[model samples]
Target chain A: MRFDLIDHAMAVTGAIIRVLVYSILTLPAILVVMSSFTNGETMSFPPTGFSLRWYRAAFENDLFMTALWTSTYLAVLVAIIALAIGFSAAFAINRFSFRGKAFLQGLAFSPLIVPAVVLGIGLLQLFAWLDLTQTIYPLLLGHLVLAIPYVVRTILASLTLHDQQLEQAAMNLRATPLRVIRRITLPLILPGLLSAAIFAFVTSFGNVTVSAFLTYGGRVTLPVQIFAYLDTSSDPLVAAVSSLMIVVTMVVILAIERLIGTERLA
Target chain B: MLAPMIILLTGFLVVPVLGLLRSSFLSGNHLLEGSGFSLEQYFHFFSDSYYTSVLVETFFDGLVVSLICVVIGFPTGYSLARLPPLARRWRMIIVIMPLTLSLVVVVFGWLIILGRNGLLNSLFVSLGIFASPKILLFSRPAVLIVLVQQFLPFMILSVMSVVTQIDPVLEQAAANLRANRFATFRKVIIPLAVPGILVGFNLVFVLSVSAFITPRLIGGSRVAMLGSLIYERIMAELNWPSGAAMAFVLFVSGLGFTAALNALAASRFIVRGRRHAL
Candidate 1:
């Protein structure tokens, strides 16, 4: 009877703690969502009242809109470029037995672990030294490096899970290597590729540290813009923009969850 | 096929990082001529109390966060890993959502909650716990809380991966031996789960040390970290050389710590394997 009571008490305590921690994890986002509808300028808890004024203000502001367009285009471009290369690398790694293969894998994945600050500044100095235009190309290149690792990781997992006998049979049928890739391999991993593209797109879109050093000449990414905005303004406008981002993130994560199992993401 | 990948990595990734290395060794502040090779910039970081302290703070912050991550995340991950298949999938989605979202976007949530007239402060006032709303923003502890929230998923996933691989029979056997839940967890579960715990520790440590946004937004000027310090040097002072040096310091140290932990994990695995053989 005593052991049962203690066991029940401990279980209840654990449940309470877990619930508390999960609340801490999820509540701030809920607070932001609720606060964005504030009718007043002051950002107060429980909000000052309900209104869409800040959402209106966010769209009205040129900085936010311009940055929004900039981020969208860059992210789309980054997704396309990173996916193309990462797909090729994943294909090579999965199919081939070659020297320096481990080296290549390390090179591809290094950017994922390396601090973005170092990579960002390095790319900046490289571009400045080369005297190339710093606005678009360098930005693409910097984000490309950061996005490639996730692309490779996801595509590789897909490739490994897939039965290679299909590809082998295609090859035995004397299908051209390129045609085999086009016909057999590509279709099999297309969903994974899409997920990888989504991963790359989000990574590039959300990037700020690299964008910080790289952005100038009226082409700041949305994150960089939001960061700068917070320096001068603390109104409901920031909340409004943040809420929109939350909605978009929610949508994307759901879409991704449907497209590929959430396990691929982790 | 390999040509494009190689070109992308070598041209855009490898060469540029090499450029950063060269710049870090340069004598001058700005990325200009008279860039004689010098270690003065490295010395500058070590010489100043301000710079060294930030370095200390960065590592200490990482240590505390990693330890907290392991302590908090282990049980959560164990629970998730032990769940039924359907519940596991649903729980994973919630765990992954925060990781998928922008750090900047998520930090915005923290910004609102930790603001002067924010949720916790209001709760305190409403409950009559305090006479007034407390200023919780722009402090290290404030940032630390958010950091744990942000990086907690990585730790959880790390633990889950290993815990899932661990055979439940081992626990059953321990129970059959009349060991209680606590004893089974301490004797069997923890020993088996050390690899995962170490992986989670290494990951959380690397990430927290390298993180820029949480400290910037949540802690702000009040908490000086290596990331923010490097940002200020590069952006405000336009000191690429100094910034590059600091950045390298962070990178190399993070890598070193990772290597050390890997070695530790490997040695333990070997020792355990030998013991099992006996």
Candidate 2:
């Protein structure tokens, strides 16, 4: 059989088309980041110069610092609380066959689909009624609601996929339920829980819609802070902050990818 | 175990939804007052042609965006799903990049690309496509592009999950029967993938309908999607009744699409069963 030149040419053409498609899709996001560093007062297409002035200004800005810390603290707090509560909820449902199980599962996952603005309004109303609107607690609670769904879903998936027979074997060996869970189930699903925590952390950290309504003068998240800055004052400083956040997020993603396989996490 | 979750959901999701429905019935004047509970808000929103037009436009946008996402996302997801199990990990990561990013960040990125002096305009100019820069930002098309990109990950993930569940042997059998490439795909793969495609459609529909930031940021004053309108009424107009009404409409339409998708899946199941019986 003769080697087919036409088929090889077609294969090369197909690969080229795929590359073009990917570049077309990804170019806009890269352009946005590049444009944010423009050296002009008004946003320009091509940069006039290369400078790190924006980073310097943003680093020196106290408002940005406060918002960054607030967001970090809120995300950490949300991750801890959500992991604690959501893990328990996931464990219960996976271990037992009980009434209203489907309903409970539905409820746990409902927040994932619920619109952020609607949830923001609901939380805003609830907090106002309880006189908790201005406090950081409401912000924390709102983030918790958002983050819990991810934790619950990942942990539930993990629990479902883990070997149930391992627990049975442990019980046969005279291990108590708690010990079996701790020694067997926990170890198996710990990677999942850890990965979920990271996902929840990034989510709460970067959230805006819910945080926008809930933010007071002193209780804004980083996204809200950047939004306010963008609304009132257009500066490269916003880009510096955003680029920093992107770096932080990318680092975390890379770390998680290395720690546990993305396949297992997915 | 389930009690806390159920209680929280009932108090939060169910009650708020009911409250939204109830608020949609009260008059604009007596919205906050406890006494007035009429169908005036609905009458206002439905009767006014301007508001009705907005609703229709938003609905059309949702449908179009959903269709586009499904068309683009399914092929990409199929490509990922068909990869060897060992190669699936990196493909999954690539698929989830958009999902992991925040909406605000995504919109921010779009702002740069769609801006008047943005990269697209620059590239177009360099390519000799236009004499001057054309504004692409804040247009309807801009909003649609960003939205499709934002939700593409969800559709991919959903369809990818179901695609992975389909048996490879079915395709092999179809090929063994002398079915060509397109025929094999149509007969063997599409039937198994109907549910996942419907799932992707429902998700995209519901989300595209409710997206706020992308429309507001990219659509600007030229376009008004339902979510942006709801935000305007609530925050700017201080019309809580109207906001609640619009929210109720969005929620209903979302559920409607979901229900329709479910019905389509169910009928498909019935048809498949009859075929099997025959």
Candidate 3:
């Protein structure tokens, strides 16, 4: 009886600790959302009153608007390009048996292991050396490097979950190789491809460390703009902008949950 | 099919990193002006006390943050694994939502929470925990807190992945063999969870060690870390050689730590496999 009582007490303690830790993990986003509606000119906790003036301000600020557009455009391009390359690479890795297969796989996933700061500085120097610092190519290439790893990892997981027998069966049924891929393989991995695109988009959009180094000619991504803004000033506009991003990210996450299920995501 | 990816990686990643390495060995501040290969920048890094301390502090910060993540993440992961599938799915979303948000947004949230007259200060003052609002922002502790928040998800996910794979039958078997809850946890659970814990440790360590924005914003000029230092040198000071050297150091240490952990994990799995065979 005493042992059962002790076990019950321990379990309760563990549950309480879990709740506290999880709360801490989610506290920042909750606070940012709460403060975004502040009526005051400056950001504060338990914001003086509820209003959406900052959101209006964030939208009206031309610098911020341009950054928002830039970020979205860049992220879209990165997602499409990363998906095309990642899908092909993942397919080849999953379906082929060839020499240096392990090396190719490792090289594809290598960016994840390299610190973003290192990659950022390295690319900054590389572009300077190539005299390509004046264009948008540096930012695009840098983000692509960061986004590819996640895309490959996601598509690889998706590819591994389903077997190749279906592709083989299509081939056996007198289907052309391209036809088999178009009819069988593409449809089977549609969810994975979608998930991979989402991953690439989010990775590119949320990037700051790499973007900070690569932003040039007065064109900055939204996150880097926000970072630079915070360095100079503190205002509720940032809170509003951050809250907007939180909503967009929540939508993306919900989409992933719907597509692949969050369990697989974990 | 793989040609495009291989070409992209070789052109961008490999060539750039090689350029970085080459620049680190260049003698002068300017990359092009340096005539011959030299170790001047590395010598400067090691010979200078200030720079050496920053390296030490960076590693110290990584170790502390990694340890805290393990301490907190293991329990959370265990609980997450124990939850019902439906409940677990919702909780997992909440856990992962912050990771999807930009690091800047997350750090901004911390700035508000830890700022003077911020939520934490206001709450503490109202409860008489402190007589007045305290300066919580722009401090080392604040940076550490935010870094942990930023990277904790990685640790939790890693641990949860492994703990979910542990067979419940073994735990039940331990219980049926007269093992107490503590005994089962200490014997079966800890032993099985070690690999996950190690992987999480390496991840959090590498991440927090190289973290830039969080430390730059929260710690400000008061707390200097290698990541921020690299930024200042490369961007603010235009000292590319010195910056590249520090970046290379960060890269090598991260790779070395990961390799050591991989070796350890491989050996552990081998022992576990042998035991299973027996």
Estimate, for each residue in B45-150, the C-alpha lDDT of model 3 and write its tens digit: 9999999899889988998898889888888888888789988887899888878889999999999889886899989999999999998988888889899889
**In candidate 2, which residue pairs get closer than 3 Å at backbone N, Cα or C atoms, i.e. clash?**
none
Model 1 RMSD vs true structure: 2.3
Count of backbone clashes, every candidate in sequence: 0, 0, 0
Q: Model 1, range B1-278, lDDT digits (tens) per residue? A: 77888888788877888888878888777754555799988998889988888888899999899888887888888887888877777778778767777777778888778788887788888999979878898888988888898888888898888888999888788777777677667667787888888878887888889788678778878898898888888878998888889999998988898888779878987687567536
- Cα lDDT tens digits, model 1, A1-266, are 12444446656766775676577677767878899999987888879878899999999999898888888899999999999999988989988999999998888888867677778878877888787744688888888988988999999999999888998999999999899889998899888998899988888888887888887556788888888877666778888887877787777777778777776665
Off by over 4 Å in 3: A1-9, B261-278
Docking class of 1: medium
Off by over 4 Å in 2: A1-21, A36-40, A231-234, A264-266, B29-34, B268-278
Q: For model 3, what is the alpha-carbon lDDT of residue A127? A: 87
- Estimate, for each residue in A1-266, the C-alpha lDDT of model 3 and write its tens digit: 12665567668878887887879878889999999998997777889988889999999999889998989999999999999999999989998899999999999988877888888988888888888988888888888888888898889898898878998888889999999989988899899899889988998888998999998667799999999999988899999888888988999999999898887776
DockQ of each model vs. true complex? 0.55, 0.38, 0.70
- Tell me the tens digit of each residue's lDDT in model 2 across B1-278: 55555555666556655665666677764224454677788888899998889888888888888888776676666766778867776666555555665566667666666667766788899999988998787688888888888887777777777888988887777667766656655666777787788778877888888877778777877888888888777766767777888887887777876797689778987587468436
Residue A141 alpha-carbon offset, candidate 2, angstroms:
2.3
lDDT of each: 0.82, 0.74, 0.88
Order the numbered candidates by DockQ, best leading. Answer: 3, 1, 2
